[model samples]
Target: MNLAYQAKRSHLLIGLMSGTSLDGVDAAMVSIDTDEQKNISSVSLKGFHYVPYSDEIRERLMALCSVETARLDELVVAHYAVSEWYAYAVSQLLAATGVSAEQVDAVCTHGQTVWHVADSTPFPGPNGMMPVRASLQIGELSVLAERTGIPVVGNFRARDLAAGGVGAPLVPYADMILFRDAKKGRLLQNIGGIANVTVIPAGAALEQVFAFDTGPGNMVIDEIVMLGTDGRQRFDEGGKIAAAGSVSRELLEPFLADPYYRLAPPKSTGREVYGKAFVEQFTGEARKLGLSFEDTVASATALTALTIAEAYKQFVFPGMQAEEVIVSGGGAYNDTMLDMIRQELPQGIRVTTSARYGIPDDAKEAIAFAILGHETLMGRPSNVPSVTGAARPVVLGNLCF
Candidate 1:
């Protein structure tokens, strides 16, 4: 169903993203039209797809992720390789669309995040604090521009970090604009490799918004799947295996009570906190207590859902008065996780996927980056201060000519 509104657009952009889900690249082709106030923005996603990563590349990427300096050079090469890979995906997508390069205005790529240490930063020269600001997403946009012969806007996180923000959950800015409901408060929860939320108060000023990381989303669950299945599975498909297992409340209770869950908003985390080390600690403790593999996976999934609901109640709802939690990302496909969230949510707060708004849950993030690219090319700020904690609104994303 082609929405009649977007047919009048003057710009069409394709956005690509490979999120924390560690699943595959999601590419979305959107045609957008914005007005002088930037308030009258209309967009239609003309096409979208989730292309799974080849086993070989997926393994290699996973192997290099969050590795120490010993593999720094290798990781750098991997980043560039992934960019080319994404370009190839985009080229195929365009070819399949029968839309010429001339018909497309740009390609927006989220690249890939290996590690996000938004809590700290490298030394900032001879004086002031390092701004605790630095993030790396390596899929050279210039190469994408060169290969696709389309102006590309990528590396969107650096600007936020430069302005003293967590530089994570940048997608919330897109959520605020695209998903806000004028009648009811909206809590947009994305369960990618990482789970984060954006709270938009209906009819409130932009500054009244708030968003942040809710804790490990698919990061821990994927790790457990890989380990328990001996690398046979990239993820816990459909939550079937998880549903068959039992959650260890004793173990899960303590994990849920983690201080990170209690921390104030604007906080961020990555594999650094919930990665291999975190898994090792979790497993080691489980072993010490003689927990079963099923128990481990079940608890990890529970933690992901519980943390989101807990965060919403404590921080977001109180401020935004959210009555519905719109879900998206790979986690939305996890039936067990969804069940936990639906059960865990307080009465009156309904849970639904991005599909309710005509956006494919899997491709929403990729589409969002494409929208951000649209914003950047038009000389706009994509940062939501309430979400990113940045110093005022600033135009984000680096343009690679």
Candidate 2:
């Protein structure tokens, strides 16, 4: 069945995203309506559910992200395991929403990103010196399609990478549709495992969008909490732990000086830069400096705010006059993180969450992929050349029926 043809009527899509946090799969059931010109005039997120990864499953997936010498066989098994979980999430969504699989237009998933390197790093090449950039998102779409009995669109980044793009921050394209405002210059900031911001000038055209990752979000802070509690806590719930401590500039400056922070826009990053290894090294040095556990977590939380503020000061604010910074993802739930960002940024800017508009902070990313799948089904290009540094705009995602 051709998705585009079926989408001539209203389309309902389920977007699944398991972010670098390795927490769980976020599934959003979105109803979208497109005009004859294939422009999405309206979209509604009818349902949202988060199916958490069991401790064992999360351990396996996190190991895949950072294991010293993970075997290919292990990678293969984890991939299918993730796919089956995604299918389970889809079933759960349908059951909760009272929507049948037969009625769903498609299930679009971003899969689990075990590795993503978007810069010109030199790796072993066929002959000699070659700078290659690559990314891998596992969870077999064919398995998802087979299990769900619905068309699945996965692998949404390869074509963009092949066209010379970073294949990241793909959510900005969806930001244009989901959060753009004609009167207010809005900054859509998603603070997931990795933090990223998309700047949309008031009534800005697609080309005017500016976006890039702002270092670590919940990952570093969460890691510190996990270590502090010996894995008893997955995150710093509501920023209480962070609030209990004081931000240490001495410890925070090193994180700010990281080379990744200085890179300009059209850039992206992941756990590859701010994951377990990075957290362990920073925490080791913090303990060596006699910093308390609370202070260490506080500093990491402040790093997220300071880096985001500095990114805006250097890259975004000068070019785009943002009225409000609307935050999303797991970080939005952290009151301390939000307060730090609000204080670090200029007073003129107001910090809030996507929920103020319509979408919940946690569900925004999943919703974005759902919208992207709808665009792909409509035969419309979804990746912004300026945002992802692609050679040109291209329809993203691979279709599996």
Candidate 3:
């Protein structure tokens, strides 16, 4: 059988995603089929699994995200260790689904984004000092392929960055495939550690799609919870902490004024802007305001909700006027956060989760990469040029067999 022919037909692929939340890995077994033009014809989720990172591993990844603490030796070791965890996730998914590694077509892994800098900075290059945008997602693809005995596709972001893109919100292309509606415009809002939205206009073509990071998602709130609990808790769980307190306007106002919220579209951000260092400043401000820890958490939750609504008001509503905002990722589980977003938005825009559309919030990203990996095998471009500000549509990811 011709390999290219097989790629166009329905095949089983597994996708692994370890998002910015630094909580765990999500593994999804997906069945995808493409049309003659290499466009997705159909996709379905067959099985899914979650593998929580040990506290030690989470700490190590957090360290790697910071420039102040990362060491080259530790980065090298963590890369290999993270790949092992990804392979373990694949093995667990295969076992739970009664499948075998040999039966699968490919494995698509996003790895772990320890550092992502999308803004152009003057740096040494082949042509002397030049402006460059860079991002690093580390999980050794060769190690994963060697362990699983299947071809692997990883580092999906690097190719986009090379093509002059921000190398983020890469899932917008997949969201278009999964959520586009003919008569109703839709906004696919994903709230990982960072929050991003894909705006698809009513009966729009591929060229009309646009997206960008909205601001902090659960990163700040999670950091506050972890700090307040002395590391006993890593997140708000169900937004309970925030629900128990009031949103401190003093704290909330400062956060809402961040310059990132005012940036134009085609922008992206990560821990570099909202990580532990930002959280420390937030906590210091809270202490000065005499606000309790719970109040600070509520304020952070409000920050995420208000910023998302503000992004829509400023960038999305003016053009697309989406009828619904479909929320996903860990933030979807936060009821208080959801309610706040609902209240902050203008009337008549429904807020819901991906589960209503047959995709689990936790598994959506992993499933997306599964689709992207299949595209790579078919020699099709998956990056959305408008969303990432790439020079052109380009096939993403490097294959390892």
Best-matching candidate per TM-score:
3
Q: Which candidate, 1 or 3, has the higher TM-score?
A: 3
| lDDT by residue (tens digit), candidate 3, 1-401 | 22753545678899999999899999999998767765678999999999999989999999999989899999999999899999999999999999989889899999899999889999898989999899989999999999999899999999999999999889988998898899999999999999999999988888899999998999999999998999999999899999999998877786787788889989999998899899999999999999998999999999999999999999988876778999999999999999999998889999999999999998999999998888788778999999999999999999998
Ranking 1 against 3 by lDDT, winner: 3
lDDT by residue for model 2 (158-270), tens: 88898899998899989998888999999999999999999899999999986888788898998899999999999999999889999888877766888878888789999
- Any runs in candidate 3 off by more than 4 Å, and if so which? 5-8, 36-38
TM-scores vs. true structure, each candidate? 0.93, 0.97, 0.98
Q: Is candidate 2 or candidate 3 better by lDDT?
A: 3
lDDT of 3 at 17: 96
What is candidate 3's TM-score against the reference? 0.98
By TM-score rank, best first, the candidates go 3, 2, 1
Clashing pairs in 2: none
